[model samples]
Target: MALNSFPPGYTRIPTVSPGPEDYPDDTDALSRSSSPSSSSRRPAWTRSFHLAAAASLFTVCSLAIFSALSATRISLYSQSGHALPLPTHQYFGLETAAVPPCKLWGPGLSEARQNVEAVFYIDFESANDPPLHPDLEDVAVWLEGPARFAADVSYAQKGRYVVRYTALDAGDYRLRVDAFRRTQTGKPYAYWLPLGLDTYNVTVMRQDGSRLRGDGRQELALPKERCRGDEVGSRGRWVRCEDTPLPCTRYGWIWVPRDCIFHIYTPDELAKQDLWIALVGTSVWRGIFFAGVDHLFGPLAANLSAPTSKFWKCWGRLSAESAKMRISYLDFRQQCIADTGALHCSGGDYLANTEKMLGKMAQERGGRGPDLVLWESNDNSHSNYTMLSLYRQWFGPSWTGAFVSAFRTYSPEVPYTHQEAGNIAAYASRNPEAKVETLDISRLGGGLFDTMEFPLKQSATFHWHNKCDYEGMHSCSPVDDMIFQIAVNRAVERQRRLPPRAPTPPATEDVAEDIRFCLQCPPSLDFSMRPEEDVQCFAGLPL
Candidate 1:
């Protein structure tokens, strides 16, 4: 019989759409169809039901295939053996066709406890016949959320890259892992360009697995005695100490001066009062600026342009209703020259420019200069020999003059080079009245003296090269974080010594009368206020 033919007891049923309810079985339909009126309806309903079932199965199969091809191929596994779902793939590269493939392995769980360390492993391979991998330094990992910080990245076994970091606060974060390809052109020196990016979601929880409200409480502290100014040991060498525990653990294995404390000021603590901080130095200062801002705020926008002028300046401001803090970075290299552009590393031009910048800041704030000024000499611009000569020549009157001026005005904190630390110490001894305080960051790494001839990697007791670039000139995030911590710690200490201001009175005719008693408030008087409430107040204001 033909394939389309039906049995003799039944009449053929025309095709029709399936209804919401399932049709009766074919055998049941046949029995019911014995009646002439029902025969046509039952068979047609049965056929439609079969067609709908077949279509549904086909649709499911097609969807499964599509998802298998489009879903992310990477896998993430946490230390506790939990697996996290991969996020949808996002493209990041100069050319789509040239983009390489990458695989990631690490803690799969999306949750992490505050102050607990998290580690990730990633590897990249080109799509070419023989896969090529970039160097360890080429990989960059960025963690952004309630707290912004740099992850310590290093090479792992089997060509895998390992990244380690600690979440300082509890919140949702995005961990971005990027692979880059280095390219050098005649115009621009060697630079790395992104080849791909893999982003993962991370939820940092409090130590008890709860949520954290504002910037959480202080995670780490140091002994009060250890918080003094950097000390110099025998032979004028800055006293060295073991690695201190930073909130992020970025400096766990790094060595610093004995007096270096890792007390990071949170945005909540800093938001208490209006402050103006100026960082003056060379290109390295720019990196410090970015690192410092990243720690306090979230990462800066990727499209933000860097300053490129001769006297470049970049400003970052944190504005609150009660407090406003401004961080400004100025290139001091151009300031060391005379008005006629004559180069004099030991001339008064450097001090003149320092005063000029401070004057400008005071004008902006109604005659209040910057509350804190951290100065790092622009030694990166000059050769080691030139710097040594300049340090020697300025040891007498020029050095004393600048220190005296800065001490009297701003109580500036200066971070000196390893070679110059001795000179700074000697100057402090000869001129005890100047009250010179030096933050010795020279022991960290990437100093001008650590050149090719005297490689810090070979001679340093601890591993310092990993935190610095090839030339030992530019430093990575870890070094920058250390410098920022030291600078801010000194700033906080200075702020604590200042006398509390009278509370501001509400705008009223009796405002002056209300604040009269506070006009001569003693410096030793303790206001007993919370950090966030420690704002400057005028004398003629309500208490």
Candidate 2:
């Protein structure tokens, strides 16, 4: 959009199209020229000769044309807005509510595993960009705990407009801006923060002290202990005491800050979110879910594939946008199907190929075939009935066999699941001499930002994935968390209700499975890559 006017007031800002030459008075030109009357007065033969001589009269017509041009400039632009007869404001400049959009840099975290990390970036270069609250300037710094949503803050230097958050134990945390200044006018400065997880403003925290903030406004000097855990830089000397030093040019000081505080998590908050997910989730999906395992294993980032080759072609990409999905569909195939190099195939074939497709991920990975093999050595068939019965009960009274056709296939290799492994798990329970207690999968621990490839919304109880979304050919949108949570919570409950386990039909697919969804789903951050640039969960959308 172009400007309607400059800073000062002046409606005289008319279309100054007509030039001074177009408005020439021409009075002096007339005086110097011979008059037409004088030319007509010449004698007949002489006048004929005189009329021929009157060819100079062309100058007379030129004067009339110039006068008309000046009239137009004065008429058209003298007034505007509602005064025009035709549509006047169809493309008005100063009236638009929309602004140029800024791209949302994805969540910021790096695998180099440094002392600090950048979670995401927000571009703020638009007329409609969310205004920077004046309060932000007044906020000095602060600390936050689990109950608090604020990330711990630190200063890169005195004039920098940037900051970061840090902690010791890993989980989730959010950054908040709480600047409230008092003025004699009784006005307020900026004061807003997000309330819950739906905004995806939902944060993940850890204990590195090295955290989610960084700035080039580095200090020229470094404190003695600043480089303790960090390596010395390229320069012979590790410290540079000068201010405004070049970026990556030398090392600077680091510490925790104090306006950047936590929102404080409480048992009450969990109660507010409704802890019912724990009670019924297990009966939905058993060993296939990773959320339950996530709690046990720790944050997902800790267990991330280690090398660049292990990562989604981590070396480099064509762009900020391209890099986001650089891991092409072909690669998804090679890794899950063709590249049987080391059984990295999880979701098995059910994740990618249709159940009707030629191959079954379950057969390849799930006890060498899709169908469950019953062993007489296993429980006397009562075990199989127990599982199938529970599966049928959980599907409720309305499902067709569709659920088992799709969801039942081994995901990520049938999960080494007792239910899918069938009656044997129950028989194993019946046998007195089995060696181990039960399941012995890994634990969830390690670095911050540990997350599954595809995190599920809280409402998901259990559902089946077509080969396209899961393992068959490595299509993504992974939902290991929901299934994990369901199983674990059920296991925890079993501690209270021991075996002679109830029956559950493992195979079934239905939309009704999702019993609840967050009523306050934060409006999607379609703006994360657009103008609203930030989301509004607590403090009405910033600006």
Candidate 3:
């Protein structure tokens, strides 16, 4: 229910490993054999028949096994919109936001003669998407078997919520809960990404410079609290305790492999799931080694410069492998919306590309209403530029709302400046009242971001057009400054001040149609894969 994710474009690699439906039925096959000698003594033809028969039997057994496994799974669905189970004997509690035991909830189980419990611990940090349970009301739980529920809003537990369930019978059963939003609106959802890639350096050294294509080896990545910029890029934080970094690295960057694409040779069915990849503004632009669009304070330097072949090489691979061709650009747009909904755009100066894509769909479908739009990047550059002048008056804030980088943190030619990044942070920090939540659309695909004052339950928005810096043991060409600036605007609007008294209009038939159109918009093609055709300007659609 909570928007606890980040920007999209994850690599969904096709695995040869067994899926949830696959199971080993070799138990029966092995049991039927009295001894290896007897099995080997069977006639060749008979043995072949036995093998084929076992294979067929295994297939059927697998299905039965799957059914049994699924039946035992803690599926938490509710029909009455709500319900509860009585406890046989046990206490209830909440858990932390870690991965193992893996923040799960299950129906009551048993150990020996004693009754066991289901732990409902929500990990806000480890979650890559929105919070499993959004608002408490949006949440509904039911315990199978005879059930009774115990909840106390009366006793103050401080920041966390509490619930308890008990069972009355010995029969086996599960406890389930459906999470949703009950309030009109709530706090934003944020996620922490150890290895965020936006921009980077082409000449960066590998974390250990040991292997050609590894990010080192480690069990868990350390959190930001324990580290900073000095921390290696390949790993979150380098530990002085161990001679090695928190985790080691083979590549100079986080997720970008030596091939430069995470999701390689993916299948179509898993394409949607591969969009979880993201680019974080934790570092500035690295156009010097990336797209060659460094931000210079002067007029001449302002324009994009020639980029190295490596920049295009990396970009080309990323485009083809990413779920949507323009992964970084589109995901950034969606991120802002997912964090806080429409509230993120009160001042309305921020420009997000995914939002523009949705807006274009709404227009194409002939739905009309008050529309605020952000521009798209990579492909359809002019289409985005043209939308600006289409309306005589702008509904959102003007250029004044944009962030202005204050100083240069990077010094190398084409290097990203912290001053540029400062601009984004400054703008967003100034607009704290923007009520930026839900407008973070990217939550539908990847991450979440909240305000700086709060836990960030989501992500930090807004940044100057700085490239991704080479941080950590491993390094990478960071994201483009242009895109970084766009994210900054998106983030700053998180705190934009709104004009009082504008209630949201009712949902109309057009809106319903618009929603459908927005969802159906096919993924954009990669900029590197376009046909070499010239454009003869035909009558194009207008905003």
lDDT of each: 0.35, 0.20, 0.21
**Superior candidate under TM-score, 2 versus 3:** 3
Q: Cα lDDT of model 3 overall? A: 0.21
Model 2 bad stretches (over 4 Å): 1-162, 167-470, 473-475, 478-490, 499-543
- Please give each candidate's TM-score: 0.35, 0.17, 0.21
Off by over 4 Å in 1: 1-225, 229-246, 249-260, 299-324, 334-355, 363-366, 380-416, 432-436, 446-476, 496-543
Number of the top-ranking candidate, with lDDT as the measure: 1
Instruction: List model 1 lDDT by residue over 376-419, tens digit each.
Output: 54233232212222322322322211221111000001112344
**Consecutive 10-residue window with the lowest summed lDDT within model 3:** 443-452
Q: lDDT tens string, model 2, 1-543?
A: 011111111111111111211111121222232212221322121011111221110011122332343311211111111100000111222211232232334443221122234443334354422333333222212222222212222222322224243332233333333221222111111111111111133333333433343222232122222111111111111111122111110011111112111111111121222111211111112223212212222222122222221211211100000100100000011112212232233334322332222122122212122111111111212223222232223322322111121122122112222243333334335643321112211111001111111111111111221111111111111233222222222222222221232322221232112111101111331101121112111110111
- TM-score, candidate 3, is 0.21
- Lowest lDDT sum, 10 consecutive residues, model 2, at 317-326
Candidate 1 TM-score over all chains jointly: 0.35
Models ranked on TM-score: 1, 3, 2
For model 2, how many clashes? 75
